[model samples]
Target chain A: MVPVDYYIILSAVLFTIGALGVLIRRNPLIIFMSIELMLNAANLAFVAFSRMYDSFNGQIFVFFVIAVAAAEVAVGLALIVEIFKTKKNINIDEMNSLKG
Target chain B: MTQTDFYTILPLTVLAVWACLLLLADLFIPKDRKGITAFLSALGLAVTLGLTITQVGRENLGFNNMVVVDGFSTFINIILLASSLFGVALAYGYIKRMGLERGEYYTLMLFSVTGMMLMAQAADLIIVFLALELLSIPLYVLAAFARPNLQSEEAGVKYFLLGAFSTGFVVYGTALIYGATGTTSLGGIFFAASNGTPGLLLTIGAALLLVGFGFKVAAVPFHMWTPDVYQGSPTAVTAFMSSGAKIAGFAALLRVFASAFPSISVDITAVIWVLAALTMIVGNITAISQTNIKRMLAYSSIAHAGYILMAFVPYGNKEVMPVSVAAGLFYLVSYAVTNFGAWAVVISLEKAEGKGLEISDFAGLAKKYPALAIAMTVFMLSFIGFPPTLGLVGKFYLFRAVIAGGYTGLALIGVVTSLVSAYYYLRVVINMYMREGDPTIEREQWLDFTTVTTAVATVALSFVPQWLFFMASTAALRLF
Candidate 1:
């Protein structure tokens, strides 16, 4: 019987935290995790909103978002592993060989 | 799905099935014979193009109104297929020369093209999100396809990080929109907005959606990832991303805003106006400082996005909506052709390990190869919106539409920024003809053919733009 506003507020806060992690994190691994956090936060909001609207569409979208996140993680992990092989580091700060 | 639903997405179905088949077929193909994959990819695109062509002039909704088959999607699909064909052709030569030939490249590009086609057809928010991911994930892989190349890896990481961030924004926005209106369908949202004043949640949701799409189209403020990503990725991949992503992003933007949020047009138009103006100024002004050809073109592409956004500044006006949208579509087509041609020239001049990409490398191109230089000149002129080029006609339509909507100031800003753009676009020409440095270019027949064809089309179509414009206007009419 939790209020929906509380759920929305919680979701927004979690989303902001995830976005901040993405901005502040330098490790690619952590950045990928942050992106997953952001996606999960959106999923939470989607499910909550679905409950409020009494519609199954939002829940269906969440299922798809989960699938997409898994695909993204697969690609992200592959990229991280590739970069790790060459540079011996996954820190974004040191990854800047390409510049003007 | 019903038979009618299947028919509505026939072209996309064809493309998706072919791309999947090509992905598996690529595994058995030898590396030395990867050209077969590229050739087959182009053939598939051509077949899909023919299929899409047959569906023109029809307007219907299928999949419970989750997908639309209309003039708009058809026109955009035709442009997407043509651009992808050019992408495959350009990649064929560049990849071979760089020793980066792989069947996977063509397969991934076909998948990306399929995503773009689906994006144009999507009528529901969930479909839009799916389409965006479908298009973007493959691009991330392709950007890094030049694995072991440090810069390519960097480009892939940057693009993937920012791209996922933007996708998060889109999903959250969709959630908010569904919460506010209780429906995710564009038509349903329109009915809701028409019935009553929109709530705060709806407005915020729409703004978030803009931020998401703004990143995709590389509009200013959300364009931080573009320069590095475009410059670091392989030139052919950059070319496809710039044109293909921009066309699809704008299609979705126009569809969502013009159709779904018409009632809140006044509020959103102001936001669009500011975004367009800033994108023009920043995209053009920044290009002047870039020495790398790919980086300069990246900024130029961003500035072009600003001009396209001008068409949406009038989206709220029912009277001018169709004209403005049609003008935007025509501009996309012109920009795609001119951009691919320009990149073809760049691909020819570039060497492995990213040497000879500086603007200075273009010096003396005219003396070395007159035909190539002239083709480059045509692309430069078109980018600068000079006469006898499709860029000019596209601009004329855009400005006319905006002026008709009473946004003369926005039109004026567009003109001024284009003038500013001439300084850099023509700088390449000046570097080629006016300066003197020996430039070495690879002898690639496919690249040369694409460059010449696009350059000629840029000029030839300008002289007879009526037919294309007519098609665009008809397409725009269906959105209402």
Candidate 2:
């Protein structure tokens, strides 16, 4: 049988990579995918911990995280598309109209 | 699931159901008569507020103890409901004038308020996570409500990205807590912590939770999106978002930390102390250089977030927690009122196409319209914590609480930041009353009403803060 420690280690690695992607990526779509990757990483950790603890609460929480991520995607993608409509490009650096 | 459970969430259920019904009713309302939708939204808030009033002086646990309806929840809910009413009033004329009138504005606002009320009552980590999204998703839409306007759209996307990023931290933190404590409920986690849960795991989880909520409340290092979002969104939406989101964020922080993690208070308090100090310093110093009024107010909101963070410095100290929490609540009241009043004035002078928003726009405002200028001056004074305003009394109570907790050095930092803040706040007052330029002032009735009423409240409430503080004292948090 596989140990829970391995699951936690894998999820932690995925979470770190996802965080780095969000910081380094310039495209809003890619940044958003990184966010989703981060959420899924946490979801993996939650499932592993739920099994380790022999409880359903962590699994239930993973479902909530999934649902919220979906909602965020709808809003975030609409925002990105709207930005694209005006600028013809959605580079993060170009969103400087209201900058200080 | 039971009578007690339903009773605990009666106010929330009523508001949520009313919001859904209002969304349906708005379909038949004529396009030009969107004002009816706004009126209906305020009516729902009033109904919920009435129910919330009756819930005071009584306490109950709901949903198998996932949420508690108690004095603290009642106190915060009243503030959220009242702010929503004010939100509807301010948005009524502003949206129509901006050509952004839509029925969904009010419904989304109502949905956001429901989430805020839930934040105040949350007794479990799951509820906290759910409530954060419920409140934020609508705001992301509302921030971008000005569709074709690139600035507003940018604000929407920026807010969404940062908000989603913060959610990742929160979820992972919750997973860690669950792993260490084997439960997602705040009370269960506390119980586990006391019974030999792994200390290192629990501390890391708590710190991660702090980082998530810090972003939500606009604390330093997580506050990069605040100014752009505030300066870009519609003025009326900025007015509502500044007050509602900060209040809800702090509510969730107080609820989760005070109830669930007092065991780790010593380790966390030092970090909060540094955060509060840095937020005050950075927010105040940055505000001094802003050329636009909206950006100025945005930084001011961030600085006040620091003052409120002072209340959490001694959250684990049983002797000082209630007093400090009450002080924090009092400061939120003062800040919300002044915020709405200031934003109302900003809304009044704000021209379509984003003209009349700079500090120079306020030049000769007093000469042209003494009444509006004076009202604006009053809000500026309240922001500066000057005499004869609620801001002064709020600061007094806050500093007193901080000093009582033996964090006098932190209290001194707050005082120094307040002094530094006076420069920018007074500049607006001086421009409004003394400088020479003609400013266009819109005279919509609702705009005038909210500005004048909140300004009056800011001054009048200062005279009798004891009664309000007395009420806040009774509205203390309870535990399982």
Candidate 3:
């Protein structure tokens, strides 16, 4: 049986990678994928905790989170498509002229 | 399982039902009748605002301590809903002009309001994260709702990316704290914190969570996205994000710190103090250099966030928490009204067909649109903390609270930065009255009416802040 700490550490690593991807990547799609990765990391932690404690509350929360993440992905992808149509480029740095 | 639970969630339920109805209603309504959705949203928001006021002093936990309905939540809820009402009114004509007058816009706005209300009431960390997403997802779409505008699209993408980045921090932090404490309940965390373990995991978790919220509120170091996103989004959406979203962020921060991590939060008090000071200085200084109206206001929003952070200086188990809550609450109301008025001026004068927001474009507005120029002047003055305005009263009360709490240095920084803010604020006035140029813009009748109504209320409220201050004082009392 694996120690609970091992699961916790693994999830943290995945979350950090997702954060780094979100910061470093310019493509809206990739940034979005990073966000999904982060959410999955959170779900993984939730499932781990539920299994550790033998409680249903953490699993119930994971269900709601999955629902909300689905909605977020649909809306986020639609927004990215709209931006791509207008800007014709997904480079994050190219969008910096909006300052005063 | 009492009647208060029903009463507590009554306003939230009202908003949800109205949003669903509006979503379905939009499918059948003609294109031109989009104004009806705005009107209905305004009415629904107003009704909820009234309902929230009825639950002001009632302190009850709904859904097993997951949701708290109390004075603090009610106060911020009123501010959010009031601003949303103003936003719907402000957006109605702008949407028609831009040809983005769809029901989705109104529905998204309604959904965002639901999220904000939830943010204020959430007692559990899990609920807070859910509420944050609920608040953010709609805003990301709204930011890019301008289909063909490249800047708008870019703003949406940037906000989405950064927003998602911050969410990761919050959730990971939450997971760590849950791991250490074995529960996600706010009360459970507080109980654990009281034991004074201050585990490394809990400390890192709390810091990461602050980073996430700090980004949301647009504080100094985490505020990189604010000016860009504000400048790119539509003017009305910018106004909503500035007022409504900032309120939610502060409310959530207060809950997490005040309730969840009170033990080790003392170690963090110095860091918050420093952030507050830096946010004030950086925001005001950057705002002074801005040539565009929206971008300047964005920076101004950052400065106001700094002021809200001052409330946190007195937050951690101090005798001054009540005063801090009062100051934060009052400032929120003042910002909601004043910022809405500023955006109302922008929406009114912008070209009926396209962009007309260069600060130079407002030259000689005093001569052409005296009413609007006067309104803008009032908002700027209130924002700068001029006497006889609610802004002045709010700032006065806020700094008094700070000084009473023995943070005279922080109070002094607030005063100096506010004075610095006045220079740029007055630049708008100087252009309107002192400079010479032509006002070539024509306003639509509805937009014209909105400008007049907002101007009148701003001036009228500036004169009689007693009513507002009285309500705020009572609301502050209810928090304790």
Candidate 4:
């Protein structure tokens, strides 16, 4: 049988990779994809724990999280597209005109 | 369970229903009739605010203890509803002026408010997370609702990215806490923390949770997105966010920390103390350097968060709980009104071409628009904690509570920084009265109504602050 800590470790690693991508990637779309990966990593942990603890609540929470995540991506990407349409660039650096 | 008990959730339920109706209205309403959406949404919020006031202290556990009704919740509900009404009114004119009037704008705002109300009432961690997303997702869209402005679009993207980043931390922390304790209810967490030594996992979870809440409240180190988002969003939306969103943020902070993790070690309190000190210093100092009025106020908002954090220093201490909670609630109410007042003036000064937000633009404003100059001066003085203003009374109580809690040094720091804050606040006044220029900088005329009313409210409350103080004290007592 697989150890619980192993699953936790793997999920943490994936989540870290996602965070790095968000920090390093210049493209808004890639940053968004990185965020999705981070969220899915969280889901992995949630499902792993649900299975370990034998409770349904954790799984139920995952359902809500997925729904909200989907909503967030849809709206977020739309805004990004709107920005790209005007600026002709999807790079985050090009959006610095709003700085104080 | 009982019929009267069902009425306890009336405010939240009404708001949810209004959100759905607004969504439908958005789909069917013509572009020219978008003003109807704003009016309908405002009416719904007004009714909810009335219901909340009438239902105060009618405690109930609705939807299986997920939503709560109590004095604290009622107080925040009133503040949120007031700000929401102000936003809708301001949006009516601003939206039309910008030619971006859309039914979806009001609908998203109503829905976002529904989420905030839920966040304030959430007793379960799962519910809190869900409510938070509900609050955030709509705001992301609204932040970018001005599709023509590239700044608005950038604001939406930044807000979404950072907001989602924080949520991941919050959820992971919640999951860890659940792993440590057996349940996700705040009561259960409190029982576990107080009864037993908080284990390693719980400690880490608690710290992570603090990070998450800190980001929401825009405390220092987690505050990178605030100035950008506040400056980039439409001025009316900025007012709603600065006031309405902030109240909900603090409500959640108090709920999670004061109620859920109240008995944690002094280490946690120490961490909060450092955050308060830095938030005050950095927010005020950065604000002084900002020439852009919106960015300056955004920093000022962060600094005000520091003052509120002083009220939390005495949390978990038995002798100081009363004064602390009272000071916090009073400060929140005062800050909400004063900040909204300041933003109302800023919005009135804004043109569709995005001019007049610079601090120098207000030069000779007193000559062109005497009433607006006077109102802006009142807001600035109130923000600076001058006497007779609600802000002065609010800060007096907060510092008193901090001193009473034996944090005299921190209180002294707060007072000194407030003195430093007076410089920038006075700068606006100086420009209004002393400098020479034409204040022909114009926008929607309707903004004058909100500006005048907010100024009057601030001035009027400055005189009759006793009632507000008493209400805040009463609300504080109920919380303890």
lDDT of 4: 0.83
- Model 2 misplacement above 4 A: B477-480
In TM-score terms, candidate 4 sits at 0.96
Poorest 10 consecutive residues of model 2 chain B by lDDT?
B471-480
On DockQ, the candidate that comes out on top is 2
Query: In candidate 2, what are the lDDT values of residues B1-480, reduced to their tens digit?
Result: 898899999999999999999999999999999999999999999999999999988887899889889889999999999998899999999999999999999999999999999999999999999999999999999999998999999999999999999988888888788878899898898899877744877888899899999999999978999999999999899999999999999999998998889988889999999999999999999999999999999999999999999999999898999999999999999999999999999999999988999999999999989999889988998998999999999999999999999999999999999999999999998888778898888889998899889999999999999999988778854432
Q: After superposition, how far is residue A86 of candidate 3 from its true place, in Å?
A: 2.0
**Per-residue CA lDDT of candidate 3, range B1-480, in tens?**
777667768899899898999899888888878778788878888888888878877788887888888877887887888788878877888888777888788899999999999999988888899899999999999998776887888788789878887887888788777766777888888898778677988888888888899999999999999988998888778888888899899889987887788788676788889999999999999998898888888999999999989988877646787767777777887777788888888887677433668777788999987877888898899889986566887788889888887899999999999999999999999999988988765466655666666556656776776777667666666544
What are the per-residue Cα lDDT tens digits for candidate 4 across B1-480?
Answer: 666547767788898898898888678888788888888898889989888889776666676666777777887888888888888878888878778888888888888898888888888889889888888888888888887688888898898888888887787777777766756788778888788887777777778777887888899988999999999998888888888777888888887777788767576789889999999999998999888899999999999999998888888787787778878988998898888789888877787757889999889999998988888998999899997687898899899999999999899989999999998889989998999988774556557777777778877887887788778777767665
lDDT of 1: 0.93
How do the predictions measure up, each by TM-score? 0.99, 0.99, 0.94, 0.96
Q: Give lDDT: candidate 4, residue A83.
A: 86
Residues B1-480, candidate 1: write the lDDT tens digits. 888899899998898899899999988988799999999999999999999999988889999989999999999999999999999989998988888898889989988998999999999998999999999999999999888988899899889999999998898888889888989999999999789889889988999999999999999999999999999899999999999999999999999998999888878999999999999999999999999999999999999999999999989899999999999999999999999999999999999899999999999999999899999999999999999999999999999999999999999999999999999999999999999999888887889889989999999999999999999999999999
| Candidate 4: residue pairs that collide | none
iRMSD per prediction, in order: 0.9, 0.7, 1.6, 1.3
Ranking by lDDT: 1, 2, 4, 3
RMSD per candidate (Å) reads: 0.9, 1.0, 2.2, 1.8
Two-way DockQ contest, 1 vs 3, winner: 1
Question: On a 0 to 1 DockQ scale, where is model 1?
Answer: 0.79
